[model samples]
Target chain A: MVELVVFVLMGGGALAGGVTVIKARNPVYSAMGLLGTLFAIAVLYVMQLAHFVAAVQVIVYAGAVLTLFLFVIMMVGVDKEEDVRETIPHQRRLALALGLIAIGIVVSLVARGRFAWVPVASAAADPQATNGTVQALAEPMFTDWVLAFEATALLLTIAAAGTIALASFRRPVADTAAERTGV
Target chain B: MIPPPEINWFALLPLLVLGLGAAAVLLVDVQMKPHPKWLVRMAAAVLLATAAGALLQGWWLRRLEAGETVGTPLPFSGFLIVDRYAIFGTLLLAAIALLGLGAGQRFIVSLGRRAAEAIALVLLSTSGFMLMLSTPQLVMMFLGLEIGSISLYVVAGFSRQERQSEEAAIKYFLLGSFASAIFIYGVALVYAATGSLQLFEQQELLSRVAFVKPGVLLIGLALLIVGLAFKVTAAPFHGWAPDVYQGAPAGMVGFMAAAAKVGGFAALARIMATAFEGYIETWATVVAGIAVLSMIVGSFLAVVQSDFRRLLAYSGVAHAGFILTGIVAGEAGIGSIWFYLAVYTVQLVGAYAVVAAVSGASSAGSPLASYAGLAKRQPMLAHALTVLLLGMAGIPLTSGFIAKFGVFQDAFRAGFGWLVVVALLASVVSFFIYLRVIVTMYMEEPLEDRVLVLTVPLRLVLWTTLAMTVVFGLFPVPLLRLTAISLPL
Candidate 1:
């Protein structure tokens, strides 16, 4: 019952936060809404015993990603909201209607008990067997995923060096006649 | 303490050599004040070493097949699979990178102090694609694809002084990221459906348990196809090729184009043949449809392109279609696929080398207008372009013809006869595309009295490509048989 209560609260919080992310007029509010959603999601991950993912969710998403979003919002001077007029005729009405239809489908499906809240039975899918802790993740990451882990170094190198290659403001002798002289 | 997984160092030699080489090039660039020429030579040596590593792997694989104990072929827990296919693909990519380094010597030289960066990125991208070609694990494939693609994104915009180069970089980066997203999502869906990201494990699972609902799996497969199709620039997903080709430094365009196609086709062929073999009825028809569309669209659009780069880009699209013809046959066409990729990519680099010669090394846009009477202006280059263009057009006594013949025969035998017919028609139309360039080079009056001062490196690249095209066209047995052993995925 406590699990059910926590699930309902967190799920509702996530949905509310998602709605606010789009509906909020202020950019800061939108970011706050996004943070709320992220936190709710992280809480859900914790409930699933995917503790490592939940930590990453909190650290990466809530801390780093949301901070970046806020930074951009501040740097860009975030008073720009769309004019509250529909670009398309009845876009808002149609969106509302579609949203209603979506919610109706979900409600009907839930009422009919059609949703499989639990996943299929599998060794890999068992939360108790393969808890998403750092220790649980470490073995495969080093052994089976070792190549992928190593390849990420290459990917990071590309990112670092590629940025410098593209953004570096040094184009010395880009089209000099030395090329013509074959010197 | 858990024991570390066993790693076969022999299987990983090529990738390690390339990774270390890339790091060395960057370090050398910063530490030593070497001339751009020396950097080019260094990069070339690195690519050659990469090829040598692949050859070593090939020799080792041969010994293993002969009942010699050299350790497990699938090392790193099956993350890296070294086989004839991997060896052939690695050799092909490394050779192209080497030739590309030779062909783009002028472009690299133009960069002056930054030449080392370009060389390092090239080596890195080649290593990435080699990984993509060799790995059977889907997540690893994604990682490899990103490594190759992200490097090319930067390379595509190497001449940042040109506005179009920056535009090309942005365009390729955005579209490529989207394609990468689509690919990872596909991988996720496949994993969700099958509980495994390794293609071999997925195949075993799929063969064992017949899923009542295979919708998610099929969608995942189609998504994978679309993502790879974008990389190979097959029609309907080829919107960015012309712009990117025209805008990127002409010297490197061919290399960039070939690198993606080679890796993309290698992975595509393996995925279809190995993992989805049982679902050939479904995917084969889809591939045939894509092949038909690529041919028709690539052929028709190529005729109208006024820019030489754009024209080559469209012809490349058509070639992508031609290569897809080989894929439609599933397992039987692997040899043909490799044969076509090997020859066509060499021609691709050579053609762009000529373009780099005509245009300045760092310039964007080689207007077709500039090529009028190129034969009168520069006979050697005109003749060189003629050979490569004719080779691309699949004329008799050229490697293109043999490549086309091998693929067409495979498709026909695989019951994709109609695809072969469409491809043939497309081939005829594409002939006109190359012929147009040839006529512009030979028959038309010179737009300007510009002389091409052919460097030794450029000359060497041209000669090497021209020699390969003719030699393989006439005596295709060595390459054909070499490719045959790389079969069955």
Candidate 2:
């Protein structure tokens, strides 16, 4: 009964947050709604004992991504009116059609067999169900996935260098001088 | 305490050389006042060394095979596979980078201050694609894809002064992220279905386990195809190609298009061969369908483009269709795909080098009017372009014809005779697109008598590609043998 209550509360919160993110007129409000949805998802992850994923969800999505969103909103001016008119004819209708198709696929598969929806072969492929922890993740990161881990360092370097190349003007000496003198 | 995975340093030589070489170039640029020419040489040397390393590794693999030893060295717990296919891809990508950078040398020089960053990004992107080509695991492939794609995104908008370049950057970035999301979601679904990230593991599980319903797996496969199709600029998902190719700095566009094709197709081919080999009946038809669509769409669109760059973009789509036809043959067509990719990418770079010379290196548009009577003034460049364009159009006595033949034959042998027929019709339609350019160059009167500056590196690229197209066309036996041996099978 307690689990059912918690599930209902979090699931309802998530759905409401998702609806608000799409429906809210204000950009900031939409970002907050997104945060609410992400937080609900994190809580749901925790309930499933995927604590590592939950923490990552909170830290990365709720914390970092949401902050970035708000910063952009601040810079771009959150007071501006957003145009919600359809740019393409029948776009909403098309979207609704696609959504219906996806829902139909899900419903039909679920109705066909529970195993059809469920990942049945996953059990035989990997029966290990260790609690989500740093050790569980770190082992693979340091050993098997070490190349990918190191490659991320290069990816970050590219990101930094690329930003510098893109944002910095061609004549840096003149630009820096102008900036320093407040010209 | 657990020990670390066994490392094979030699097997990873191509990646190490390219990545460190990129960092080294950046460091050298900042530490001292290096000449722009020196930087170009430095970049060229790095790519050449990478190609040499790949060659050495291929030789080593051959030796291993001769000894009847521990087969298919999956270094780093199968994260990287040291096989002939990976070696071939590594070698080909390195060569393409070298040729692309050489062809774009004038543009690099014109960058003036940001030359090192541009060079470093090329090397880094090549290394990323090399990693992508070699990896057997999905997570590693995604990592490599992002590493390659993010760098290319920045490079596309290198001419930030142009609104078109900025628009291209944003469009590629946004659309690319969607494709990546779709791809990773497919990976997640595949993992959910089989609880494995390794393609072969997924394959083994799929063959062993008879699911009550494999709807999830099928959907995952479809999603994977869609994602890769976007990368290779296949039709219906190729909206970004013409704009991005037209808007990007002319120098690097060739590398960008070719690198993505090389890496994307490598992953696509490997995944289809290994993981979904059990469901060939389903995927083969779908691939055939995509092939036909791309050919029809790309060919028809190419005939209408006024911009030379946009025409090349559409032609690339058509070529992508031709290559997809090879994929319909499954593992049997790996050699043909490589052959097609090799000839096509080289031709693309050569063609773009001409565009860069005629239009400014960093300019957006390559208007067809600029090429009006190109042969009157710049005969050598015009001739080189003629050969390359003929190669692309799959004319007789050109490398393109041989490549088209190899792929069509492969598809036909694989019961895709109808696809081959459609592809031939597309090929004929594509002939006119290139012919239009040739006519504009040879027959049309000059718009102006202004001389075009042809750089040494650009000349070198033209000569190399022209010779390659002609020589390979005439003596295809050597390349055919090499490609046959390069297969993962």
Candidate 3:
């Protein structure tokens, strides 16, 4: 019952956010919807026994990065009066076809005698379970995957440097205006 | 589930070396001052040495027969495989970087700045690429992908002063991060259902309980495909390619597009071949859909682009679609993709070199119109550019044509006949765009500002690129044989 409820929440979140991703008038709102959907999905992960991944989903997706989307939205803030394009006429047909195909697949699976939802065994004992915890994640992370981890850090550093470089190079508005004015 | 199989060290040595080399370059750049070209040279030399090591590794692996004794595994547990495929691809990428940089010497020095940091970053990016190609584990794969991606993000905006470059960098970073989140989430779900992250382990489980975890695993696969698709700039995920390519410096743009795509496809190949192989019928349809969309969208889009760099970006998308067809073909497609990427890296890097040389002043950037009267002004460069362009168009006598031919044939052999048909049609559509470039250069009259002058090294690079394009296209038998031998049976 808990799994079903969590699934409904996640499914609902996904449907709502996916629609808003295309339908929202403001890109910022669309980004917010994406964030919400992502969070709900992370909750689903927790219910599915992916606790560590759920935490990572929140940290990496919701916490560290989506802010970039917010920043871009604010930076490119459009006027409220600007006309937003709605979905095209043929889009609904595509959606309908996809929906039908998906339903067909689901119905076929149900017919195949595979809906047995065996409950998961009780969560492993605490000591054993802790080994699968985030703390344990650190060991393999540092030793086996150390090179890749360090590489990520280096890559991000370069991105920072590049960002600074690009910002420094933007044409000053005064110069653009001067050029326009035949200065 | 059984834990991952024993670590294969020999198969992972190249990645270890690349990682170590990247760190060394970063430290060296920090400690040194911007002075003579020696710093760039040193960085390039280190990369070349690494490439040499990778080449030797490939040769040794090639020497292994069907029943030869296995070699010792390289360090870092069992994350990466140091097989010939990884070694060859890594070496090729490194070589392209070296040659592209060497040809770009005047261009960099003319910026009145040091190339050390930029070169170091490029080297580090290549090292990330090495890891990306070789890593067999999902976590390791993600790590490699991010390292390569972040490096390219910085490289895209390396010019710093150009607004377009800034816009491109920001757009790529934002979209890429979003896609990555989706991908990681999918990974989490897959792990939840299967209790494993290694491909073979996932595959083994998938074969046994495919019906049991159908919903979760299928969803995971879809999300994973979306993530990888975004990396390769496939349809619906390719919004950032044109702007980013146009904004970046030509040399770096070439490296980013080729190296990044190769790494992305490598991971894609690994995933489909292992974890998702059991559901070939389902994922094959999805991949086919993507392949068709990418072909149509990328081809038509390229025909309309006014910027040469942007056009190439679109062409890159179309090429990605073609490559994916081979992937959709399943087993036969894997080795084909490896071969095709090798050809692609060469042609793409060569083409971008030409673009960099012609685009003037390292700062003004390459506008499509700048090529007006290119043939009259610089016959040699024009010739080389034409060959590369034709190669990209997949015309006969160019390596690209043969590469496409081989993969499309492979697709048919693997039971994706419809995909091959769509691929051929896409190729025809792409022909117009590629020829548009050729016509603009040859038939179109030169504008007033057009003057072509070639430096010695630049001339040499152009000739070499041109020659290789023809040689590989016409005499592909040897290359094909070599690639086949290298591929895991």
Separate DockQ for every predicted complex: 0.50, 0.41, 0.18
User: Cα miss at B200, model 3 (Å)?
Assistant: 1.5
lDDT of each: 0.90, 0.89, 0.74
Q: Let me know the DockQ for model 2.
A: 0.41
Docking class of 2: acceptable
Encode model 2's per-residue lDDT on B273-311: one tens digit a residue: 888888888999999998999999999999999999999
For model 2, the local distance difference test gives 0.89
Name the weakest run of 10 consecutive residues (lDDT summed) in model 1 chain A. A118-127
For candidate 2, please provide the TM-score of chain A on its own: 0.71
lDDT of 3 at A37: 83
TM-score of chain A of each: 0.73, 0.71, 0.61
TM-score of 2: 0.84
Best DockQ among the predictions, by candidate number: 1
Fill in the DockQ of model 1.
0.50
- Candidate 1 lDDT, B235-274, residue by residue in tens: 8899999999999998899899999999999999999999
lDDT over C-alpha atoms for residue B78 of model 1: 86
Per-prediction TM-score to the true structure, in the order listed: 0.89, 0.84, 0.76
Q: Kindly list the per-residue Cα lDDT of model 3 for residues A1-183, writing each as its tens digit.
A: 656776897889978987887788778878888888888888776665567788989999988789878887778774446554656878878889999999999899888967676434223323235433465676666666665555566566556544544444545588788879999
